[model samples]
Target: MTHRTLFLTGAAIALVATAGLGFGLGRLTDKTPAAAEGHAEEADHEENFIALSVADAAKAGVLTTTVGRGGGSELVLPGRVALAVNALAALGAPVSGAVERVHVAVGDHVSAGAAIASLRGAEGANARASVDVAAAGARAAAAAAARDRRLFEAGVVARQDWEASQAAADKAQAELRAARAQVTAQGTPSAGGLATLRAPIAGIITRVDVRVGAFLTQGGLVAEIADQSAVEYVFDAPPASVGAIKVGDEVLVQRPDGGEDSARIVAVAPSAVDAGAAVVRAKPTAPAPRIGSIVSARVILAKGAGGLTVPADAVQTLEGRAVVFVVEPKGFRATPVITGRAAEGAVEILKGLNGGETIAGKGAFRLKAELGKGEAGHED
Candidate 1:
């Protein structure tokens, strides 16, 4: 046979084989082209599934939450994490004294009652002396009261005299307690009578003005500390929205890093402030983000309002499609979803999910990354 003829015959055979293979696949699937395409897509979806145990998912911080009913409307407001008023400490000089030693500096973290500075002066000496004096007075008064009580019982003293002595003893004892409380609250004066200024709360010191040997008057600012963990979200809402916003309403706070946290409204200003703008406050369910980090707060005006919602972070992009990891008995499956309006750190699931399905929420990004790694490994 000629080479050209041989080539043509081989080409025809290749075409026939291709057609037979296609027909065989169709018969095996018992599906039309569209149906087969769909089946292949489903297989691809299955491949993206992550076979992570619930324990492993928890370890990875892939926290799962039930898809919940969303409110009819959401109130989105600009807000920020702020230090609680009580969490801030402006450490001041407890007495008019010169700083003898500085124990901490700006940016230092100190536990509650940790010393910040030492001041030695007559004030501390006087406080120590007052405690000693109160103790001595208490001892003397108690001895006198005991003598009077015995004399009265022996008919050697009047009842009024015994009562007076008892009163004196009680007053002296109260003074002693006050002195001791003062000593403890202001820190025990050292052997040399140095008063140690200490942190009132656990926090990071933001400022320090005292230096060794510097004289500071009582109540003078020595340093400032802020408990970063003691933070709440504050939002300024329009006056029109203030009426609908209420304490104890659910709040969804979105951090700059894309993490979402749930909170409850803690305070709503009785009236508008700052050019008629109303203020709202929320207590976060978890430790808040850094103070001053700009965040958006979605306040659920009416809880149990109506539609299915999941955390915004629950939705992720996989292969250019919006997907969420729906939990399964054995593992998780990435489900394609159609999303609607988002409010309160939650996005509405318009389709592709039934209410009550558990899905990866706050740390859903971890699962997305995990699924990507799985796809990469399969390709290799």
Candidate 2:
């Protein structure tokens, strides 16, 4: 073939190959939408169920609970364990003095009149010396008054002189009594010019603010003792829920360690606190928790007839709403629920569940996570 003839033939062959390639591309582009639609349909058919084999479910610790009836409405209040007011005592320095010695430490158990510490200072010495002087003066005045009374009866002394002696004796007696009272109020005074600090109530020392050689001013706190045999749970209840809490209502105290104690509402403040929360006090029916422990409280507001109830752990937060996983033959399905009060490990379900529905109790979160994963896969 000549050069011109060869070029024309090559061009024709190239044109045919380009046209075939364009046709193939057109067919692929036309089928792309149908294939994508099929994929979309498959994703749409993906159910919101988490299927697990028996072995897998067992490994996940999936447990089922049947919806039941009977549980009262409860109002949960946040509070801390506090020493009973009548069972607590605050010790303070009776006189300004330097602490000579500290006998007890924080957490020490002490009895009434037990020596806690000793304080030494001029104030204590002066108080004791005044007592001694007052006693001597009183004794001298009493003797003179008795002698003057006898003389007056016999007309051996003037009436004015006898009367004056009697008045002097009475004044001296008053001074003596006042001095003794002062010493008694100051507590026991030691021989070394130290005032001994003593526990006024039998209790466990909860606080000790003084140390050896520490100078304490008068009325300064030395220690705090609490009779924790009886403690009260003081909690702040929302003002909206205060009306439901009445004195004598049953309360459940949940400790930080997951233990529970029963209590009864003893008192409720008439007004709200700074956060518009009411202060409620409850006394434990059994042994109280350690003082100063922060514990959760559930106050039973009212009990109604049998209502739908489920395990509290079964409830989970999904999409910012309370939900529970219902066990189906294929898998578990997440169901939105309206919850009411909760008590004694069970929560009152007002809606979204009928009685006898089997639900995931302990491992519901596993199902929720699986569902989330499936949704994410479909999105991708």
Candidate 3:
């Protein structure tokens, strides 16, 4: 064969080989199983079933409760336990002085008239001197008045002079009475011009601003006492929530420690505060939390027509929808729900649930986390 003919044969052979290689690659791609198997695994993960044995569930604190009927929606607002305005007593220095002694520390229970501190100052000295001088002047005026009466009766002095002496005696006696009142209001005085600071009302001392030997200016805070017995829960409710809450509605105060107390709405401000929130006050039905405790306040706006309800904690948010895990024989299934008003520590389920169904209560979040883990594992 000629050289040109040989070259054509070689080129035709090369083209055939390339076509065969392309066909082989297509067959191999169709046989691969990884992508199909991965998709199947993801479909299974989306089911989100959490399986736990009875013992395991108990260990995980997975609690369940039956659905019931309830009414009302709770408007949970942030609040704090504070001393009632009428029950707060702030003790300040009646006059500038150096604190000579401190008899009590913060948290000390004190009764009315109990001595809290002692202060030595020139003001106390001046207050005492005024009382002594007034008393001496009163005595002299009384003696003069008596002599004037005798002189007028015996005709030894003119009637006008006797009358003038009697009027002066009356004015001096008035000054003495006023000075004595001033001494009583200034509190008990001791030696070295020290004035004892006394509690004006029975309460627990919540603050102490003065220490032994601390110099306090006039009107400076010495201590603060609060009567916890009449404590109030104060809430700053958002403007949108203020309209839902009204006086006489019941409120639930939740402590930071997960404890709860009952309260009744006593007052709602007509306008918002500087923070653009309305101030609400509630009186606790049970013993109040310690003063200055920040807490959660849930106010019941209104009780709607009776409907199916579950424990508030039973509901969890999943995939942007509220869901409750319905307990099954082998595992719990997350069921989406349409919820309505919530009240009395319970939530109203408007749809996706029927009465008498057992559902996860307090520890439902564990199941949600477990489901999330499964999805994340499949994604990897």
Candidate 4:
């Protein structure tokens, strides 16, 4: 073959190959639409399939709500029950004496002016003897004064003599009065030579420091009596809670026996202990368990006027801020929230959420993971 004919054949073969490739590409482009339609149908069927993966379903978890209440905050403090000073009585001996006999034992309830013990001592005995002697002297002075007065009135005695007699009688009467008071103070008259230690107040004898035959001083304590009808609970609270706790605020006393009692804040200490802790006192209406008994108290700092609140765990940290996930039709969304004081395992959401929004109550962390997965799948 000639060189020109060879070149032309080669060129023709190249052109045929190019044409065949273009035809094959065009056919491929035409079939692609049908293939794409099949894919679209499969996707439509998948969209109807509501089956969520185990992980995705787990991410949904349970739902819960939060509410806002009118309470400031609650401060729980450990405390102990004590006798109100006004209700406590300390029985003391008016004179030095040996306790001849104890009429009351510990835990014995008594009334005001009730005899708790009898004291036999030299001072009490001397006071009784002086009272007897003064009584006789007073009688003699009275008779003499009366005779003098009659004589002066009858003009048988001088005015000066009658006046002097009157003065002497007045002195004698004063002496007798002093002696009687001393005898009475020792709790003895002629009733017996011994002085009886009377209860200073109406209450139960919580403590007995004296027994029969125990010698006690004039100012020595005989017994401690406390009214068992009412008690006081004293607790120390943080200084931050000072303003929150008010006089007459409700208090709850937790007994060690698994029972609860109610009380009201009677006094809030003006000063703070440990710089940041204030002493709060409450009066319990229930029977006084015992003096110096340990108890727990819950002081209500605020009350419920009721708005919205959510579980504390439901709020999570996102981008260095507090947030909660609200399930939206599109997916789970992170909602920023303004949180308030948390109490009772829940937190107050001051803002960012309205009531009736479904929140992931159980597994919020799992929801975050599923959301990340959905985003990744979209990118793919």
TM-score of each: 0.59, 0.56, 0.55, 0.55
Better of 2 and 3 by lDDT: 2
Cα deviation at 363, candidate 4, in Å, is 20
User: Local error of candidate 3 at 194, Å?
Assistant: 2.0
Write down the RMSD of all candidates, one decimal each: 20.6, 13.2, 14.4, 14.5
Clashing pairs in 2: none
- Candidate 3 lands at a TM-score of 0.55
Provide backbone clash counts, one per model: 0, 0, 0, 10
Q: Rank the candidates by lDDT, best first.
A: 1, 2, 3, 4
**Best-fitting candidate, scored by lDDT:** 1
List model 3 lDDT by residue over 1-380, tens digit each: 69999999999999999999999998878744888788676556547577665457768998877888776556677899888878989998877789999989999999988998888888777877887888899889888989988988999988988888889888988998887776666654543568988999999998999888889887889999887787899998765456657899998889888998899999998554556788999998988878789998777764665567899889999998899998888778889876756667888775678777888898888889988998788788
Candidate 3: stretches off by over 4 Å: 1-74, 146-163, 190-192, 255-260, 270-276, 302-380
RMSD of 4: 14.5
lDDT tens per residue, model 2, 1-380: 69999999999999999999999998877767789889777556355667665357758887887888876656677899887879988899988899989999988898989999889977778888888999999999999999998999999999888889989999999999998788777765754567888888898998999988899888999999888786789998766556657999999999889999999999998554456678899988888767788899877765666568888889998887789888778677888876767778988875688777888888777777888888888787
lDDT of each: 0.84, 0.83, 0.82, 0.74
Q: What C-alpha lDDT does candidate 2 achieve relative to the native structure?
A: 0.83
Clashing pairs in 3: none
What TM-score number comes out for model 2?
0.56
Q: How much is 129 displaced in model 4, in angstroms?
A: 2.0
Worst 10 residues of 4 by lDDT: 45-54
Off by over 4 Å in 1: 1-71, 181-186, 190-192, 270-276, 303-380
